[model samples]
Target: MKKIDERYIEVLDQFGFGLYTTTAGCNLYHDSSWGSYIVNFNGDDFVEMFIGYAETFDPNEYVSLHIKSHRVIKDIGEMLKSAKEIQILLLKVAIEFVKISKESMVKADV
Candidate 1:
């Protein structure tokens, strides 16, 4: 694992995402209810963001990008944009996931 830029933690921390280290990886950012992001680094220049679900370290999917300056790289710059990517990718995904999951349990009589 490469050293995680503090800016990543700085942004993610605002969203209840806590950084943890498991056998899976060192830069694991998890939210108890909103899924997880397993960050894989490449020689301090790039990263792969893996999104996990159901309280596990293993992610269901991923998106990769290169690290860039303030103006940003086209893809991941979104994550750094006032946390919008976190909201859309993690927070919003969690909300919709839970909603869809619970729909099956809804009482038909109600």
Candidate 2:
């Protein structure tokens, strides 16, 4: 994904959405206090997720259904085929988000 800034990335532009997945997390790994995430596709390959802590820690929240460089989908079936991959990616990203937030909180206390 192309980095829009320190906190945002052009997810749609990166059709490699399904690449960052994990077995424990399908595509929706989240934490109650840290953050949440939802990486999926519709009109465009986008993400609705949050990384890091609250404004107190400068959270990185991505909530765009249609991000930059909308994909030219040739077949919906093709996308469906890779649902597992995408699911895994979502979980991985979400878990990472919560982990980062937790670590940050610990550091803040220190």
Candidate 3:
């Protein structure tokens, strides 16, 4: 495992998160009741990538990527796919809002 800055762990804890290291490895827990997401340190040369809450947590869903190797997730194809998914989701939400606004306008005109 790579060495990370102490401030990184402090920042994680300041936000109701917890960090623990066991014989298995270091794991990051977002909340008291949530399962831990294992921190992978494969190719972080400058700053190590410790596990942290993804800004949002869904108890029902599992992490999509397990390995933290920079080469794997940082590849062009994977990045493109991730970006495409975000774009699709954004488009869907935008379309929904547009539909709602159009209905509201029609009702006002009537």
Candidate 4:
């Protein structure tokens, strides 16, 4: 598997989203929950981002941007398994939301 940083950058770049890191090493943005986030274990940094359309200006059109990243785990085989599992769960939920949104659009068209 690719390193976490490389994977993160690739995913974000592919989706055309920008990452903002705080002075304290946290990443902040809005997603499904408006405050959903993932934290980097190295520095306890967090990341979240999403895009939305303005109902007044573009009620019929919308844009979405998503970002996902993983923190480096020093002891992959031992120390941080639970953390990794939690991250995987979070990612799964995000993906499911995307799927549901797409399905809703299709149903609306029908």
Candidate 5:
């Protein structure tokens, strides 16, 4: 498993998400109750961060966001060079994704 910043975990918690490492060694943050993933991290040197969404948060109806990477840092060496940058990128996307979700939900209710 790759080592991520503590703040990344904290951010996931604040958003009611859980982190899981896939069998293929990718990182995933998801909401189990909602049966949806918020993001996925794949690749080694040039990490690919996949941003996801769950607007209504329905286990059966939510459409997930899928991407190769929201932000890509290329040509990294063996030392996990872009951890901090990746963390910030992930956090920013997560925050915006959730904000959009909240706005959509509010509009839906009106």
Candidate 6:
């Protein structure tokens, strides 16, 4: 499996996401105020991106991004098709979600 690049890690860290690599070699990022993102790799490609919060926050909430490698090029408009594309796509969505989540929390506190 292709490892997540240091540049990507840097971006995530700046966004307040803590990175943790599992013993089995999966990548997981945790954001206390939002939730966790667990990347599931299938062979040389990413098969799924799971975004989930702790039960303490919201037990009923569970979100996932299913990445069909063969369909990614068509769906995401990526000229060069590959698993690396998943990383880029996932990062963009994750960052946006974090921004939205933080905004929602701020509104709730008002």
Could you say which candidate leads in lDDT? 5
TM-score, one value per model: 0.31, 0.36, 0.33, 0.30, 0.35, 0.33
Candidate 4 local lDDT, 1-110, one digit each (tens): 11223444444444333445554553422232222333322243122222111112121111111211344434333323333333444454345445555776798999
Ranking by lDDT: 5, 6, 1, 3, 4, 2
- Per-residue alpha-carbon lDDT of candidate 1 for residues 3-90, written as tens digits (9 for 90 to 100): 5556545545655556655445555354422234445423322223333432232221222222323333444434344233443656
lDDT by residue (60-100, candidate 2, tens digit) is 11212212346454544444434334445445555554555
User: lDDT score, residue 29, model 6?
Assistant: 54
Q: What is the lDDT of residue 49 in candidate 5?
A: 44
- TM-score leader: 2
Q: Which stretches of candidate 6 lie over 4 Å from their true place?
A: 33-43, 46-60, 63-110
TM-score of 2: 0.36
Off by over 4 Å in 2: 1-48, 51-76
- Model 1 / residue 77 / CA error / Å: 32
Comparing 2 with 5 on TM-score, the higher-scoring candidate is: 2
Off by over 4 Å in 5: 27-29, 32-34, 38-40, 45-110
In terms of lDDT, the poorest run of 10 residues in model 2 is 52-61
Clashes of each: 0, 4, 0, 1, 0, 0
Q: Give per-residue CA lDDT, model 6, range 1-110, as digits (tens).
A: 56664644665566554555655555555433222344433343221232231112222122113333332323332222322433454556456555655776798999
Q: Please state the error at residue 7 of candidate 5 in Å.
A: 0.9
The TM-score-based order of candidates, best leading, equals 2, 5, 6, 3, 1, 4
TM-score of 5: 0.35
Q: Which ten residues in a row have the lowest lDDT in candidate 5?
A: 59-68
